[model samples]
Target: MMDTWLTNGKDEGADGGSPTVFIVDDDCSVRTALDCLLRSVGVRVRSFGSPDEFLKSKIPDEVPGCIVLDVRFPGQSGFHLQNEINRMEFPIPIVFLTGYADTRMTVKAMKAGAIDFLNKPFREEDMLDAIAQAINCHRARLSTAKNVKRVRARYDLLTPREREVFAYVATGMLNKQIAEELDISEYTVKIHRKNAMEKMEAANIVDLIRQATTLGLAVHAAQPEGMANGTANGASNRDKPSSAVSNGTEYDCTFE
Candidate 1:
């Protein structure tokens, strides 16, 4: 008996984005069938007969997509290829198709982050559902990555003193505490903190902390005793001139 599965289709082109489905199968018939099936439902399809050919193809980072990979291949197994792709940080979600339904292989693939696994002669609807899930997952990941890049860019605009202030603020430090730690005037600390918040487009200290954590900048929040003291001395000797501030008053930051 064939295992059957079904899932609702998402709104086609909902975000004005075209997502591709990549099929890497050794069997020509399987490739053709998958290509036809995906294309019929408005998905862009790319098929390759071997893992080598798929690796050679240039897939753009901006394209929201997923991979439909066969488990067993001639040169390199799908599992090995998946590991290599993950090591390279390609960010494409994978759906595995295999003729031999080995329990151990399925567990490994799923543990390694495969979006879905199916045996040979799987239901067409089930494959479509897996493809849809994979594409959505890929799109969500790309969105997060883009957001991180934007946040990082804003972070880069901060002056050295402002950056220090931001780290202190993210760690729940008050203006007075930050001033004492940095050995600066309370007024100066407030000025730097305000500037950093504006540049980061944080709504409040809580929001700022969230963004910092997302960008993996939270580690800087916990300043070492020696480093904090050193920075305090350095800050004392610095000129009092304020850094130039960007005129923007609002930033559109989305978090899920």
Candidate 2:
């Protein structure tokens, strides 16, 4: 029989706002040891003697984290836990630690998207590296999710015409130039621009430019040729921030 080393930490779980690493193993000594080792590095950990116990945990909806799982347990095995993770679509990345030197098991875990599989009697450095990788992956996943939500919110708020105006405005088009290009009156252009700006929570053109740029929208000069239309000699309007527009207001930006 292979001895599985599983560990959990004293650091608070996701509720404490730190990233969580759930450890599942049958040995109490192993659990305590892992918990100590993990906590030493500032990672939050939750330990369970069996996979069943971990399943009952109330992980937060917004929390991002990983699981330090064992390959075998007394009750439902580590592979079963992996399957449950799949079925529930748990977002936490998993790293498996096992004493059993089974290539088949390693392949299966990797194919199932496990971040790592460390053989038992592993070096402290190896364990630390695996946990670090899992946490980084979790952070990125959360960021992407947040961006997606923000983008969806922005998209839902915009009207079709407003979106078109937003694109043109982002390209550094002035209201008058946009009006001429769209074959609409300057007054109509102003109305659309104001609505778009308000909806985007952009106080001025600079805020709009930054937000649009973040979303990968292009910023073009309003005039086809370089420089302001009525500028003297060689001076360009782009050289300075315009006094006409105030660069205030926070953008409710999101990826589209």
Candidate 3:
């Protein structure tokens, strides 16, 4: 498994939690310069000389930011490092900095799902733009993750009956149908559904479905008449986010 590297601290220059920027370059000058530049723009930054060192450090659990990784490193190539990061399910998005750009390399990086690639001697504004976009994406991702975590926590609080109701509700079952399935009254199913929605902090059915799925509620797709027949749909739900909590700051969890 590829080792995941994460930034191990709170965001710097946080005004209502501004995004962070991590720079991993073998060249000390590049690191320093980028750090200064990022900091000057109200972005917190951490610099590292090598990928291994970055992997060794601790990163905050969640932050709005992205990693600026050099394509060439002292030991591990950036390409391999990126692949490993993906394998580990790290949360951070990456912006690659390459000294040499080629169609093949660009294709490879894009195919591996890099956010952006910057050639050396590129304009500062371009880097800043990419960084800003990355941080915003990271922030959104963290926000979603927080909500997901909360959803799961609430799901765990439900009684086994409530959990059963939740699954039915997510699969578009009516309270009447769920009651029949579980040998309960429609009123009872409605009560349980309401309780589950309240605990999940969902405003409506759609919100409940979204939040429940995020919490791994194990909902199956509803069949044409499964609700009427009180039969399990049996088909697996295929739509769900990956296990990684990526936003911007690379928190590849594979290492863990």
lDDT of 2 by residue, 19-98 (tens): 66788888788778889987776667788888888888786655656788888866458888888876543367788988
- Name the runs in model 3 displaced over 4 angstroms: 1-18, 87-90, 203-206, 216-256
For candidate 3, write residues 1-256 as lDDT tens digits.
0001122334442324546688988988888888887766556788888888877887664556688999987657888767766664335677899888888988898677677899987678878877766665565566666666567777778888887788778766677867887999999998998898888788988888777566555444555543443344655433232333223233222110
Worst 10 residues of 3 by lDDT: 1-10
Top candidate on lDDT is 1
**For residues 81-135, could you state the per-residue lDDT of candidate 1 as single tens digits?**
7886675443688899999978899899987878899988988988887876776
User: How close is every model to the real structure, measured as TM-score?
Assistant: 0.77, 0.61, 0.73
Each candidate's lDDT (Cα)? 0.73, 0.68, 0.69
Residue 154's lDDT in candidate 1: 87
lDDT ranking from best to worst? Answer: 1, 3, 2
What C-alpha lDDT, on a 0 to 100 scale, does residue 31 get in candidate 1?
Answer: 94
RMSD of each: 9.0, 10.4, 7.9
